[model samples]
Target: MSSATNSQLAIRTRSWMFTPATRPDRFANAAKSQVDVLIVDLEDAVQPDEKAAARGNVRTLLDAADNTALPPLAIRINSLLTRFGLDDLIMLLDAKHAPQFVLLPKIESPEQVLQIDTLLTAAGKTTWLVPMIESARGLSVVEPIAQSCSRVAALMFGAADYASDVKAQPEALALQLARCGVAAACAQAGVLAIDAPCFALHDAERLHADLTFAAANGFEAKAAIHPSHIESINTTFTPSAERVTWAKRVVEAAEKGAGTVDGRMVDEAIAREARRVLAAA
Candidate 1:
């Protein structure tokens, strides 16, 4: 709820759910939902013919709502290469009420992000941007994209689209490597990397398994197609008490300048890792 700059804040992302921007009825429900990030999807979720209407609906909904309490509002705009994306940005800048983040899809290079950032800055808008790395080109250029724009807050994995583009299955190890690549890129840039939504919505066990795998592999957050998955996702990403305790102890010992903990020396690097663990908690 604070308006602090992006760098100073920790945007907790357990479950980021995408709602169809064309469906105004779903907006109110989503605003009250438990999802960490309510992504008003104006791109893939909306039919091509309804893109215009969806954009209008989203603008109206944002205007009408008291979004101060709702989870972060993000508008998933179409690729900047299309007319729809340009229109989307125009409408957003002109509106009285604007979303906090613009979720960009199919980002292939840093130039794509720079284009969006340039437009947003020229319009005198500070809306943050998060890119979706959904293709092989995007994956390969992830590092540059992360460091290119100051407006970028995170990188989201569009696994379904990426898998189709690469002609592979989602659960494959090769896909995991691609996901890790994005995570590492985000980490290097000191930003969060989000995992794509698992398609098996009905299987809670499968969702938990996937969330656990993602958490272990350095993904700070995971997307959800359904609200039902939010609780599990949140629980999975949060640090355990045991982990927190260990981190605290390490930090405490390292603060003494030079000390040994359990037969190992606690140095500056160990202290830094401990602080990171506490921060994640």
Candidate 2:
């Protein structure tokens, strides 16, 4: 792909901050923050009876035809098997505008992704998708789901739900395999891999360690529950100045067929990575 197109992909996969659908009071603040995407949740964040009202809030955000101040918005809707999920889909289809992305939770098969894509296409909506793999079944189908459709903009690893599905504590080591699988699938499919949020909101040390681990594991972005975590997540994912300089040098040499940078061989694969790093920067 051209550098312009690559830049678009790496631009805003850094920090995704989620706000409870019931909490419209916080929506404006969340949108104004330095988050890459502001996710309005209609799933776990809302109580059963309050789902309708929560959906209404999401629709209201969509209804604002002249609001250019909103950030890149997304909605984490309930599972397709649930009634609320159906309602969420209906609301999106019936709305005047659609969120740039939709976080499809508990995705276990490519068919499910296809179903949503088909529904959106039939309605003439070009909304992209972010399929969240948060269970054993979901992880097992990560490759297929990542490759399911062009509408998939990214793949998110929902560690909390996956750990619960496996009856284990949500530790990094225990969830490493799933995280690796997700990252690999995303890399292969040319989509962003988003790390799940750290639950220990008060443990600064733990959050730092988690961020370090994720940045080294092929994850390009991370989700945050609180605004406090946004800055750290963004800093961890942003390519360093030194790295960006090296990437530029490498790509420059590769374009001229030098195949060598600072006495290191720059192959096609390495050049591609350099391009990605430049894009990320």
Which candidate has the highest TM-score of all? 2
**What tens digits encode model 2's per-residue C-alpha lDDT throughout 132-182?**
998999988899999898888889999989999988777746698899889
Q: Against the hidden reference, what TM-scores do the models get? A: 0.92, 0.95
Give the clash count for model 1. Answer: 0
lDDT digits (tens) for residues 1-281 of candidate 1: 22222235557666789889887677668655678788999999999999999988877866765766668788998887999988988888887777877899999999989887887778888787889999998998999998887788888999999999899987887789998999999888877788999889899788878887888888888888888888888888778899899888888898767887667789888887677778778
Which has the greatest lDDT?
2
lDDT of each: 0.83, 0.88
Clashing pairs in 2: none
Native-structure RMSD, model 2: 2.2
